[model samples]
Target: MSVEGGAGEPLSDSQKREIAVWFLTNAPAGEIHYVAKDVRALLGDDAVYEAAAAEAFPEYNKAHLVSLELPDRSGDIIIATYGELDRNNYLDPRTAQVATVDHIKQTCTKLRPAADEELPSAYIEEFRSALDVELSKYVAEAYPKGVCAVYCTSGKDIEGPGADFGFAVVISAAKRSPQNFCNGSWRSIWTMDFNYELQFVDIKGKIQVDAHYFEEGNVQLDTNIDCKDSTIMQSPDDCAVSITNIIRHHESEYLSSLEESYLNLSDATFKDLRRKLPVTRTLFPWHNTLAFSLTRDLAKELALGK
Candidate 1:
């Protein structure tokens, strides 16, 4: 976590309000989002508290320093933990902030015992469910420009370990001008080329798998920032700058949602996966490939060009 606070020292009441106001600005309103800077104009500066919260939280978990829901709201939607500090006659603001921050950090922000990339963090022992690291790639597949910019975070451009967002750039390129996401096939695909773990919790909270990869494929967490196919932006630098501005304005569970979903998987599910991926061993002796089809009729979709 890049942000830090004096965990042992108590904060003044003024500091706490500043932090709360800071959070209020970034809080989501339905589908509309807020930029911290714009909100800060009205709320004043308190990123320090957020930084402290980040300090209190673990690495990777720092992104979720502000996960609170007002009331009667949870799941992937409205996120605010404490009630209006005004209405609650119980805990003082600092006390409430402490309790809420502490509770959230403990419940959420689990680390994915990642021994290595190429495999989903869930594959590691003592691992709990985590979003596919390549979720940015999937977001890119869906939103291309908008959502991908918010979530995708990889490549030489990002200065971190996130191929998902980097791949979102690739997705944007294709989306901005579909003539090529660099030629369409997996051959042109650089991000999310691996057959990593996949699962989703349903309304009843059952874990279900859509696919898993073949054991013999090469999963590269490419961070070179080589794929620039978007007509939407100028360069990788522009991609990062542009998209980060978008994120400051909006948010998706890019953080705590995974924390909320973290759960230990039964040993049995690992024993029985319904599908295998990267069934393209013919292309490269290394291409252990196969896999998804949700759109259109199965037949017509299957009939599209390879």
Candidate 2:
């Protein structure tokens, strides 16, 4: 497009060539459209190509001024008061108001080189390595079975290899804790991957013991039947057996309880739980009430007989 103005002059072939070269070398990618508009306006259609010529052969107009359109969608354009026609003439938002050689130098300092450093990709790789190390440590300490499964979760439940491992740990742990007679009891295992990804396993079961009683009038009685109470002493073997039985008998209940609990958590509370879980650092940064609600539900389910 050409701009209409007085003192119109036909642009020389040399000037047109210069303007094209300046745009190819200095304009940001996909930004030449606005640059062309601005250059056409300042030089008028007749001498619009002069801007390009001027950029190539600075000797043409050492004191010539050029206009540039801002990349923002605000439709704002700026005129370069004085400078060689090149990227150096580009005005940055920071020094736009104060026009000076020094300001141009400062803007140049803020411009990024066109080379890609792959920073984001490198960061993600490092984070993943660290997460793997951490998960290995947890597996060694808690799940000697070598983390049979693992899962990853974010804004919503995500099923994967990582999540499967986490579920296994939950089942194993549930088979080890004491049960509650009033309801049930549970223990949860959680892991955080790098970038704040979270993984969790829920273990739920009941513990049973026998009750003893003494009659007041010339009679004493003790019941050997299994009862859900902490008052009676039971061997470790018996405890383990009770836990395994509870897990097998109430597997569906355990899952259902977790689902119900998550449903009850408010959005804010769920976020807090995700933050509080130590596993967040190893997992991607995703927080929601669903995770918290699940944990709460497991706690309630375990407390059933308590």
Candidate 3:
């Protein structure tokens, strides 16, 4: 657990741990055992609220804030909480912002314990919205690079049909590339197909990545080839076999459909074929150009050759 909130009145380290434990154990239940004021006191006046904020939401450091989930027997509900810590004043010794605390309290008040009468679907949207806000906030803070890996229980239709239970590693590295990487173009490689997107009701554990990099092109592909054989080159001629194998190994199911639809006999046939596929266009926005690569490159970069 880590302290949260603003600079002057943040929660202490111990308090943060305690709050995190409590939230983990008693989530999805509109219940808060510790009082905000009490947390404020424990953190000491100098860092009271900030400490409490950190403890109440360790995910802040990682780019997430704590949220409370309250489910009625018939419906689910949630509320989000955020610290008063401003990025501009991150290193300053300012006190907690009163507005932040008020906002949290107001959000919390809207939630109520589960009741037996409401329909399950009645509050589903509301619950999801609240959860999203909290989750997004936490993720944004914790993973400024927008990369995260989440692990969850796997099962066959855990929630309902078309639902497969399994842990997921969410790697969100969607950031505006620096000028050197793309002349100010916002490029990223973690985009996903509509059907491949993941949904989750609850998440636990800290998100971690092996490495992060900023390069001109798809560093992920580069790293993948490099890992298999250090001599691999960015040019197709230099690593034709490796590149071919890589493409073959990671072939998209949609590629088959595209190839069949457009039968052109030329060296540039594959490129043309790919351009015609909506799936390919969406997933490979860079069109074989510079794009962010999360795991493939990060893993190799961390494993060898610095």
Candidate 4:
């Protein structure tokens, strides 16, 4: 609550507000606790940890910086930094340098090398090109009017074994300009949204993966590849090609259902707001509405009555 212990002065009102906004925008919605360095990176301010951690004590590893109670009253956000503890559960390894090394040691697995050591950068680019060609063809045949974009990734960070093979396809279509239909000036819209993300990870002796047709929410899958030759690291091209084929097959099978869902959302959900528009169905001059009176009385008459 109060700054002390030479960390620095208390955070200004602007500083507190910035910290809260930065945390909400950048940090994951499901997580509240964050380390000081993570806060520094997310906020893009190097001095945050010291100023915010001024209130922290040596006995506690977690240095509470910003405390915010949610508007919905579900819970609060306690933005803090947790110092690394040793095997005896003591906060001996408190510096950022030690924490960085510990993180590397934990996440850099044998099968998944560091980002720099993974397959050549050129190979990753090639993999991306292959995915784009194949996915673009599928999108063209499936949704002729829809705009498709592909993002390919093939690297591991200090967090986990990044996906050996991974890509995301985003399809956006059904543009609508509802300047007049909606209540306010922000009535412009584009209703259709469909995204597909696929990733494969090699764990132990098995290739953990699973296949699904279509899902409304985020979906993660796992499958077991028992064949030793299927390891992606050993045969990158063959594995990539095999994954692309699998994606094409799944997209072909379930894309129609996804389209149907989008159609239903547009027809049933969008129709409600569409019908409520002015009979002209044209852009309403909402800015001019302030000139009219709701009580159906002259201004003088209303004043006299009041």
Give RMSD to native, each candidate: 23.0, 30.5, 21.7, 20.9
In candidate 4 the C-alpha lDDT for residue 244 amounts to 43
Per-residue alpha-carbon lDDT of candidate 2 for residues 5-85, written as tens digits (9 for 90 to 100): 347965555555555557534432122344555656555554545545444323211111222323332221222322222
Give the TM-score comparing model 4 with the true structure, all chains together. Answer: 0.26
**Which sections of candidate 4 miss by over 4 Å?**
1-120, 156-166, 177-245, 252-255, 258-306
Distance from true location, Cα of 264 in model 2, Å: 32
Candidate 3 lDDT, 1-306, residue by residue in tens: 234567757665555656644553332211222344454554445354554454444333223222222222221111111112332111100111111122234222232222222112222222223323333343344333332222222341233334323222222333233443421111111111111124322222222121222342322221111112112222212222332233222222122322332233344534656454344343333333323332223323323421
TM-scores for the candidates: 0.19, 0.15, 0.19, 0.26
Candidate 4 Cα deviation (angstroms), residue 293: 39
Clashes of 2: 39
**Model 1 worst lDDT window (10 residues):** 200-209
Which candidate comes out best when scored by TM-score? Answer: 4
lDDT, candidate 4, 1-306, per-residue tens? 232223776666456645544443332211223344455465455454444433322212122112223233332222223212332111111010111111211111111112333322554545545544554454344432333333333241223323343433333222111232111000001111111122333321111112221112221112223222112332344544554444434333333333343334333343557455446664333222321111111222213322
Per-prediction backbone clash count: 18, 39, 40, 4
Residue-level lDDT of model 1, residues 175-205, one tens digit each, is: 1111211110110112221111222111101
Which whole-number lDDT from 0 to 100 does residue 98 have in model 4? 18
**The CA-based lDDT of model 2 is what?**
0.30
Give Cα-based local distance difference scores for all models: 0.25, 0.30, 0.29, 0.30
